[model samples]
Target: MGEEQFKGVFVEEALEHLTLLENALMELEETPDNMELVDSAFRSMHTLKGSGAMFGFDVLSHFTHDIETVYDLVRSGSMKITQELIDLTFCAKDEILCMLRNDYDTIPEVQKKKDELTKEFKDLIERYRDGGNGATAKGTLKKPDGKSIPDEIIVKDIEAPRYTYRIRYRPCTSCFLRGTNPLLNIEELAGFGRASIVAHMDDIKFLDEYDPDACYAYWDIIVTTEKEIDAIKDVFAFEDESSEVKIEVIDVSGELDGGDQYKKLGEILLEKGDLTQDDLDSVLGLHKKLGELLVEKGVVNADIIEAALAEQVHIREEKKSQQTSVEETATIRVPADRLDTLVNLVGELVTVQAHLTQMAVKRIDYELLNVAEEVERLTCELRDNTMNIRMLPIGTTFDKFKRLVRDLSKELKKEIILATEGAQTELDKTVIEKLNDPLVHIIRNSIDHGVETPEQRKKVGKPPKGTITLSAIHSGSHVLIRVKDDGKGLDVEAIKNKAIERGLISANAELSDSEIFSFIFAPGFSTAKEVTSVSGRGVGMDVVKRGIESLRGSIGIESARGVGTTITVKLPLTLAIIDGLLVRAGAGSYVLPLTSVLECIAISKDEIDQNHGRELTMVRGQIIPYISLREHFFINSTEPVNQQIIICEVNARRVGVLVDQVIGEHQTVIKNLGGIYKNVETLSGATILGDGSVALILDVNRLVNLVEGVERDAVKRLGMASEMSVCE
Candidate 1:
């Protein structure tokens, strides 16, 4: 890979580490005594610092190192996790993201933020050094067992008592694929103090049989350092489970008997576990060296003997020293564009499968039909698998709102808690990405307009800390995301007055509370008496409506007088493909989503004439309102003698769509109609048919809404006419 590609990988990995850090910090705030959370945060920062420096992100590495130190203190129990430190770390995490995006240390504004955060972190470190603010004394460090040890033992370069450690490291065969370089780890181990390393090359294959991507050689490293055993363990902290590592303190502070002799070669080999005691004793009687004797007797491999010999010599030289040590999970990240391409290819395959099916049905060959059926089945499975790859749990987006709710509630001086449920409900990446903005607006509106202040809430017999529940539940092929708040519900009287004042609805117009509440989504409509930073400009709900509708989703609001308000957004599982009912109205073909289709019933022009201008029909003693696609789209054609009313459920209401024919089911691959039809709200997108014809996908909810809007205008005009006549 090129330098740029390597840096890109680093950026991606660093951002992920930052996310982990952010989540851990957020949780730490709730449970300050949770050492696991502190450890988790520390690990992420440590990785970021190490990887950032390796990837040439010097400024990011430096800034991270300081923060990592504070976390290290917490990990050591030398400092307690405080709200101030958590907030500082959160700010640092944000700044690190900025640094990563701006090439680390570039961009004057980001640099300034870095400087400020660096100062704060340094202050925390100083506080720890001075044993102030819940920090331990400067001269002591906490051990794993909570015992205070002198600080000199923890410092690597200090001239204090040290230990000599022998480390055995064997990398996994697939270690290279995971981007780990064992040599780098060995080099890091050498940095602690005087060191000697010997590679055991016995596992290497012949040149012709060699695999470049596989690590065949293992190592035995001997290090004499002032650092403690934990410091040595950290050198291999990131190694995966497939690799093997064992670290033991061979000699402490180079202490030896008056003879200045280390453990005998045979005993060292035995202690190193390279040979059993039987093998050591059998070789001990030989006149030649024990290592040479063992190799000749085939009792131990030449490489193992060589490593043991190396360890023996090194430890004898200084009377030397010591050294170290740690994926539970593995993942390969592919760029999103690649997954998008795969989804598009799968969609194309679905379309081709439909064409083959159509051709087989038209032909009389049974063999061809069977082949087409098999292909159809395979295509369906392939389509589902490809879509599944793009499916992400909605919890990722939910987690982001935690920080948002925290900041916004703090700014608004309202004590509110965000509660989420069904966060694991899965949705297409496309749908999830588009759903974010709308959900943000809804939650913001709820916090600003829906929820009352703590004082007001208490007076109303509600808890001071209000709760806004964000939840998702899968309903067949659709996902319903509801943002509900236990606050003062939307005021119908206020909405009614606003609608009339804005000329949105006529005074004294008979409307349901649902209809009245919907006026909040009108452009520039607000019930707030004044505007604030959080909301009240009225753009939030309007944006929410447009964003949801653009995703071919429907949103509805339900509220009680003093209880609460719930905004429900219903979205399709995926936008790439859908099961739709193909229908024809005049020359135009349309596809109604199969999930929305209830049933189709035959209706005639005679029945329509009985209802006259009402366009309402009696279906099993129930009044069913309908929209004629032919009249709505202005398709010029003679009315069919036999018509069908396709019953569809839209926004929890069943409505019928009049069409000339119901043409079975179609697997629809939706294609955008481009900018020309962008503003056309009634139609979502268009799809290609097996016969190579274009069929428009109907937005059932929007269609019903458009029809209701037209009917409402008619009623308003009629009411005015009746009033004028009475006056006359």
Candidate 2:
């Protein structure tokens, strides 16, 4: 066929092979002794090399060959899989990706790196090759009986049913330059069975315009006789190393004479009864003189003509499928940019629908109002659909941690097991991508700092093997991701002393347990006695805090020394939009994430009390600290007759935010407040109200901290709070 068609096939198959390679490597790591995984890995590489050579990627094929050879040995049980071998395979996989992207200038350096890794692979293979005898040598397989064995094993003399060999050969563009003859390969196949060629002229250029150095023709040969597929494959063994070839068995026993030859476009159309001789003649006439024929003859309706054309197209596709080796399957590979574009379009549609709703409310036209209402309903559904497209199960990220924990535990000389729960919880793709690195850092820190050694754990009357648990769940409009470790928890006193020494807190400063523990996320803060490369470098925890914050999320730590530590991160379900509780704060309107707002109550003057010069309100049976927007934002107000208190929860702690009035629920479109307002503590983002006014989205976590900090300071001064006031 056309070069474009072949190129598409090559790219598709190459990507499939790459994915297979990655999956096989992952499986091989877990079950290194499973020969099936090794064999599958080898086949994927072999197919990739053959496909790459067909597509003019010579360097890729050459580099992959070496890796394939190593896997081949492993598949034959002559070599054993080891950690070093797996690492080398990962490097090889990376190189194959680079080669697929057509990067060749650095191939030499990459090959050098591969050579070094291959040397280690060779050493391991030799070690295993010497069997359990503990001798190291090359090019020999020694059994446990201490006897040298042959390099390769052969199985022969098996009988099976008679089969026909159908070989298809599509040479590479540079085949002629390599002094290869496709005709000679076809002739060599005669040794296996009776062979006849069906020359394909679909890819041939014009005789006068053809490039002499490029092979442009393909051949489909049918050999009807009793012979194994491998026997036929061996005939063209030399050419098969560099050519694109497919061999399959055809059962001619149930077909009519000349069936294969009749599988052409026009013949298939006739056989399928989609077109008659007269219809074909009429269409051909119209195609040749299109402008006149349409008006001159009333042969058929335009719809009928279109339908006939569609049928002809389908027929051609069916014929092409039968003639080619490619399988017929329904699948689509879309570029990532297209999905992003679709999401953006859906977002814009939602915004426009909001504007339309505004206009429809002002007009008195019933029909226009009805249309806008329907549009709003559709827009909501569309938004949800688009969001769902970007949602992926969190299990994909969790499965990778097993390998991480396995490798790290071995390195640390500790026994640790990672248990994941609710891994099927779904989150936006963007959130998952950003969460990977932070989660890895947290997991590493748990292994290095949180989990104690086996000896220490045994002394503490705990299990020798520490367990780190990762769980995710949906909470209202957010997803809660928790990393819990069964190890030594945070030491509040040590953290307090470090904060004082680092000038983070005053020496005489008094703080609660949670407040003291928060110091771990502060910049340049660490409590480790000695720094290891895995952790205690004082770099990642703060970064994790910043990353969670960047996603409009909050993180908190809960700990009990010698019990355990749990770090929970709360993130918005989707970043593009949110449901908010809009309220009037000072002269401006602010939106509080509806997910965090529990209830609102109007408080009379009698309920307002000044305790140690701090505003406090009794909600239900609990005394909750309150922060007034007027005082917090420097908004001067003369009277406070009937004040409203908005009770909100932050990480399971309740607090009240005093506002002028509660304005009802709003469907908010989150807009970034630029770099200047990024550091604003109490505001997460901004949105436009139905009245066309800009409203600030309140950060519940930050507000909780502010109000709680104020109340704690007041209680510390008065010395009247409970001993459990240390909120851990």
Candidate 3:
């Protein structure tokens, strides 16, 4: 890869490391004694430091190194993982991300942050160092079993023993073409410790035949360093598969075979498998240099003799096993746009398949019909698989809320805990991404308004800490996400009075608790007694409503006095396609998402007339309100004698939709109605039919809301003279 591409890879990998650090830190704060989390954070930070420096992010690397020192101390039990340390590390992690985004301290704001964070980290290190006589100066050194260790028994910040290793590095001939500079690796090796490096020129070709792009020279080096064997391997990590790098321990703590004696040339060669016993015997008797004699006898090549002379260590077998495991679990990252393009193509194929099926059915060709059936089945399978690719577990987004809750609770001086369930419920990537803001609004409102302060909660016979439970679950083809809080619930009388004062509801208008709670989402509506930084501007719930509606989802609220509030948002699994019940109203066709449809019952103009023009109908002896599509959309046509009322559920309530005929279910690939129809809230999107007709997909929740809105407006206009009870 080119330098720019390599940098891109570095940025992606660095982001992964940052995520690891953030998640580990968050968990470490909860479980301070979890050594595994500490180790994980340490490894991620160390890798970030090393990789940043290698990728030319010097400032980032330096910043990471400072923070990594604290983790190192914690790892060695020299310092305790305190809340203050966790908070500081969180800030440092954010600074690291900012530095990375701004190109390693190029931006003034990020540079300033880096300076502040670096000073804090340094101060922390220094304070810990001076707090006690030794390791205990910073904090108590606790063992894994939670017992404090005495200072004398603890060894902290001690230098590791150094080992001397012989290294033979022969770069592949095409390494330079693959964008590797062998010199960089060689230079890195030099930094490990005191070293002797010798370049072999025996393989160099004649000047006329030499290729500048091909690597011919190899190196033999002996180095002693305090770093582990893995550190050496990391220097050549990128080239491990392509280059021949042999590293063998020659001495440990200045001991070679525990004495001054060293291995003979024949012994080194034989251990390296460069010379057989017979070949070794032949060379030993010759009294010539073992390597030269071996080459002269044609028993080994000159390069092999040279390599054996170096006799470096091979990577341990366990390391190879680890690499194998890593390779098995490796994944390829594909750009999201490509997946979107694939889904779009699949949608087009579905439309064409529907067209083909319609044509075959009309032609009365059994053979062609069978073929079309097969095509339809394949299309459905392909569509499902394509959608599944975009499905992501909701847990990724849930993790982010933990930090949100933690910081906000601190800022508000409240004791609150966020509990989540069904985080593994999967939704489309697009839906999940768009859902962040709406969920944030819901959660923030829950924390600020729905949840009570510690004292208030304690007075109410509750625990000092309040809880907000965010949960999601699959409801057929849709997912229901609910945010529930346990604290002071909605004050029904106050909400009703406010709705009246704001002209949102007639004073005498009797409405259900759900309806009153929904008034909180109105523009410029707030129940807060005073404004604060977190909320009370009257903007959050309004945006929440609009955002959820924009995603073709529905939002509802349920609350009881002093029992807390719950906000539920129901959303489709995907935006690209839906299973819809196709129906006709007057001359236009419409689709109701099949997941919402409960059943269909026949109704007629006579039945409506007999009921005195009322919109209410009886279903299984229970009264249900219904909307006539012809009257609602003003579609002018002669009414059918036998009309169908499709019973559908919206916001946990059943309503009937009156249409002329109920067509069978359709695999609908929804198409946007564009900006022109953006203001039309009832129709979510349009879809193509088998015979090339366009059927508008109805937003059932919005339709119900629209009807309720009309009824409220009517009551307001008539001074509450005549009441219409179509919705409850």
User: Whose lDDT is greatest here?
Assistant: 1
> Which candidate leads the pack in TM-score?
1
Which pairs in model 3 have colliding backbones?
131-137, 132-137, 247-313, 248-312, 248-313
Which residue pairs overlap in candidate 2's backbone? none
lDDT of 2 by residue, 1-728 (tens): 79776767787788767767766777777788887677678778777777778877777777676676667566555667887788778777776766665455656887676667657656655556545333334433356786755423311214344455556677776788888888788777755555556565656689798897888877666665556678887766777465778776644332333343434334433443435667556656445543234325654334333333343343343345445633555447655578777877776676677777778788877888899899989988988988888888898788778768877987898898889999899998888989998898888988888999899999999999999999999987789999999999988888999988876666789888887878888778998888887877688898887788767788889999999899998988887777888888667898888877889989865556545545777777898877788777888755367778899876567788888888788778777799998678778788766556788888877766666667657765655345457653
Q: Per-residue lDDT tens digits of candidate 3, residues 551-663?
A: 87888888887888888999999988888999999889999989889999998789988998789999989999999998998988888899999999877789999999998
Alpha carbon lDDT of residue 339, candidate 3?
Answer: 93
- Rank order by lDDT, top first? 1, 3, 2
Ranking of predictions according to TM-score: 1, 3, 2
TM-score of each candidate? 0.73, 0.63, 0.71
| Model 3 regions lying over 4 Å from their true place | 1-8, 102-107, 129-328, 720-728
Q: Which stretches of candidate 1 lie over 4 Å from their true place?
A: 103-106, 132-330, 711-728
What lDDT would each prediction earn against the true structure?
Answer: 0.85, 0.73, 0.83
* Candidate 3 backbone clash number: 5
Tens digits of per-residue lDDT for model 1 on 29-48? Answer: 78999987877787788788
